[model samples]
Target: MIEAPAARAWPKSEAESLPGKLIIVEGIDGSGKSTQLDLLHKWLVSQGYLVVFTEWNSSPIVRSTTKRGKNRRLLTPMSFSLIHAADFASRVHTQILPALKAGAVVLADRYVYTAFARDAARGVSRSWLRDLYSFAVTPDIAFHFDVPLDEAIRRITLSRAEIKYYEAGMDMMLSEDIMESFQIFQGRILDEYHRLTDEFGLVPIDATQTLVKQQQQMREIVQPHLADIERVEGGDLAEVLRHSGLRGRYLQQPVWAEASE
Candidate 1:
């Protein structure tokens, strides 16, 4: 069995005392993180867990600034790295830390490791980026969905008309064509993620599997962590599924049942 990265001293002493568990799913674009996280959130809610969801770059403080910089293609690699770090810091204070203190399961779409990988790919010093995010608390469970480069690109391009400027690494000027640039840029990021898998002890999930299998793998890994959380009354998972436009009927069955059927 693959073990989590060797335990390191958590930066914030308060985080060590929190009763909640932090679970994170990370990968490049089109790796199915959001979909899997939504499923996990609903399943945990059905099991009477208090859950909070947070995503990368969702902090209000730096959203506009990052957007403007990306739109104008004005952000240097260092500036891009720092802006995302700022966004992460804001969320840690306002969103992550508080939820954990309240004993709520915190499901993050991406964490500081995302910065470590992407920033380093962009030529930032790995040690410097790690120090920049030294305040981040280690997640109880971190899964990296490993998808093939071609498959990820196919999924992303099929959904959108064209890849965004920054996502394609157009700023790096690696290729004259957008697709070529995206391939080169995302390939670098993917390689970095692979390196981080061993470095950080991220559980590798074969992302090319059917969604059902992926969710099953997620549940298996998450079940052990959920053992300590005391039950709590909260939102209805069925209603959440309905509101989110997921197939609501699945909530009637056990999570495993949904996968088997």
Candidate 2:
């Protein structure tokens, strides 16, 4: 099983209580992380494993605030970074840690590395952002979906009606054309992600491959770590507990004060 990167500080209380596994898929936008993670979640559940899925920027606490800021185009680079950090912190306490303590497999669509790449692309200091996320519990395995910038753009623009302002880094004024700015901006994030691969021990999955091939590779890597829990009979909570031999320890969810506007 892939362990958390050795450099990050893992809280002892969290370390001792963690009976569950956290698997994360990280990549640039349009890397198919959500699609792959959804399939993985379904496959795991079909095999009788309790899985909890979380996506980046889904925290209800920050949802409207972030959306409003983005709509207004009022978020500076540092503000955007901080807002996402708040969203992540909330999810870690409310969703990730709780499900993990319950012995469920936690599947994350994106992790802190998203911030590391995107914020740095917007000129935020990588070290400052990394320090901002030091309280996060690292994942057991973090997969980075590597796709070419052109390919990623083709996929996104083909699938969606239009790319949003901030999504194309229009706020940076890199180019008058949104598409051009997207290419240059996302290219930088992609390069930053490449650097992060070695620094954070991210397993790079070639995203240019066929969907079936990619899913097969993901399953092969995932199957081994879950061997112990795979034997549990499907759908009986009691049986699941008995088979996995989990004490079902509860995690004390952190009480977060409301984020100031």
Candidate 3:
């Protein structure tokens, strides 16, 4: 049995004084977290909130390098963790923090917790991963979608044609069969996620429930955060920044002024 790492200190304290909310979702693949986040994003936008959405491993600066490594099957556990760290850092600087400072709600499909869980499962040191992502601010809300292992496997098998090499944790040599490897790998990740739920106070969602029910619960949990937040007029993010009164590099440009001219 793979030994679970002891819980470590959170990299950063809970974010306070930021006018906007950062909401993130985390779960194993097929746990339905992505679908739920998408639903929440749509609902928030419909309510006229200025929302910025980001996902894992999506930073353009490292996208090609990660892809090349993956294609070549060259990423070791450590290299994979570092590449993802760079990606998250780029997004935090270029995408997340600016939006938060602008008072725009930022919806992340995954967050630092992803690294804590996935990297730990990959045999990387939990302490090192925490330090690597120390620049991250605590989310206002982080929802972990929980599902049974068998159900998660069933969902993935039904949804995908085939699982990829890295996705199956094949590099770890857990099993000869791809499907078995995926099951074992995802199980480890799920275990780490459960550990994180307690350590980080992550709100748990029953992914086995109907989507509508789950989303209803999520919105209820989110409503209090929205009480003071104004919906963006015509869904313009710049409008949120202009009215936010927070000084930052985002406000130095006259893009809004140019548009009004």
Candidate 4:
């Protein structure tokens, strides 16, 4: 059984003084949260909102190191957790905070809650993980996409030929068979996610619903937060993208511009 940490106060509340909003999503892999976030990003962009999107563990500073470790299959559970922490920190400093400071709505594919769930599932101390991410700004809205373990497994299997090593938690040695390990490992992650949802007051989204329905529900929840926020003008869009580290990604003119035309 995994050890539960003593209850502590939630991380600092959202900084209301910041002009922009931080919106994040959390869930086990294959829960459809990523798809929902993509749709949300597109909709916000189409409406001319300045949106910055960041995904977990995408920090270039540690990307090569993380890749080498995973390829060599040398990441112990603790080391794996720490590497991800570093990636999160770098992105927070370089990408997330800057965008928030610039008044762009920042959408995170996963947030610190991801480490809280995945690392604890790997047997890292929960309290330690929280402290490691103590510098993180509280998100204005955190959505948890809740899906059953069986359904999650089904979706994953259908989408890929095989599960990757660390993704299946094979490093923990729960099972030799990759598929079996994935089920057990992801089950543990799902359990931790449930605990995090209640502890952090995350808004729960039913992942089993049709895509259209889920998106409708998300837009409804997100609409009020955007009421007074202004749309990004063309010149301002470039500045926002520059600070977001996404200028290269939008080099060919943004699709949103065409949509507006």
Which numbered prediction scores highest in TM-score against the true structure?
A: 4
Give candidate 4 regions above 4 Å deviation: 1-14, 233-236, 240-253, 257-261
> Top model by lDDT, which number?
4
The alpha-carbon deviation from the true structure for residue 228 of candidate 1, after best TM-score superposition, in angstroms, is 1.6
lDDT of 2 at 97: 85
* Cα lDDT of model 2 by residue, 90-185, tens digit: 888877886777677888888999999999999999889878988888787889999998889999989999888998999999999999999999
Pairing residues by index, what is the TM-score of model 4? Answer: 0.89
What's the lDDT of the predicted structure labeled candidate 3?
A: 0.82
RMSD of 1: 5.8
List all candidate RMSDs to the true structure: 5.8, 8.3, 7.3, 5.4
| Candidate 3 residue runs with Cα over 4 Å from true position | 1-14, 235-261
lDDT of 4 by residue, 139-181 (tens): 8788889999999999998999989999999999999999999
Q: Model 1 off-target regions past 4 Å?
A: 1-14, 234-261
Give the whole-model CA lDDT for all candidates, comma-separated. Answer: 0.79, 0.79, 0.82, 0.83
lDDT of 4 at 17: 63
Question: Considering lDDT, which of the candidate structures 1 and 3 is the better prediction for this target?
Answer: 3
Clashes of each: 0, 0, 0, 0
Q: lDDT, candidate 2, residue 120?
A: 97
